[model samples]
Target: MVRPSPTLRPLLLAGLLLPLLVGCRYTYLPLIPAPAEVALPTRVTSAALTREGGALVLRARVEGRFEPGYLSVAWFDSGRELGRDSVYLDAAQREATFRLEAPEAGAYRAVLAFGGNVLRQVELYEVEP
Candidate 1:
């Protein structure tokens, strides 16, 4: 029978134990919960246009982790739907921003849809000339 040299024996032992040590080190990491399919908007803010005769730009910040899908933006003016814009997100993003130009001088609602669900809805008012 042949025996491994002293230096080679220690090297072989370390190679065998490497995987066990790495696995145990990661055992304490808590598993993060999967984001909900339908997450409501957590925070929202709106501001009026500062310049006169400038179009009102409604900006919104929506927070959620949506599945790989398309996000749609809809603009509503005075309880009536005006227009919509859609964008595709291939991977998960922590948040998203949407902007819509004011159609007329009035109150407007911006709705964000993700995976066929309404993720956020915000209201803004446009001043008249």
Candidate 2:
């Protein structure tokens, strides 16, 4: 049987412990910008665009404190409007979601808006049937 030297023992111990000590650090920085600080139109909290199956879903949240808001999404292909859908949200409901389907397999753009403010999302969808 052979024993490691004193210096080699410390090195081996450190190598074994390094993995356990890796992810235990958290740095606090007060200068970071949060999503709340951004300018919001009509007090809308969040907007999301995602593709589900062959349909595109757009969602927006309008806080109850704000007035009634309209959430609308327009589908565009090749700079032309293919279709649009909208929903009205009242105080009782703070969120609105809309789903629209693409006509064919290709790239398409979705324009999401709440009243006068607009946001755009682009996605490439392929379908096989």
Task: Give the winner by TM-score.
Answer: 2
Give model 1's clash tally.
Answer: 0
Candidate 1 per-residue lDDT over residues 50-107, each given as its tens digit: 2134344444343444456666778777788878877666445433445555545776
Each prediction's RMSD over C-alphas, in Å, is 13.0, 12.9
Backbone clash pairs for candidate 1 read none
TM-score of 1: 0.47
- Give the clash count for each candidate: 0, 0
- TM-score list, all predictions: 0.47, 0.51
Report residue 16 deviation for candidate 2 (angstroms): 72
Model 2 over residues 1-129: C-alpha lDDT tens digits?
A: 999998799899989999888867765676685667554445556766677787777777665344676767787765678898888877687777878785456556677666667744544444321
Model 1: worst 10 consecutive residues (lDDT sum): 43-52
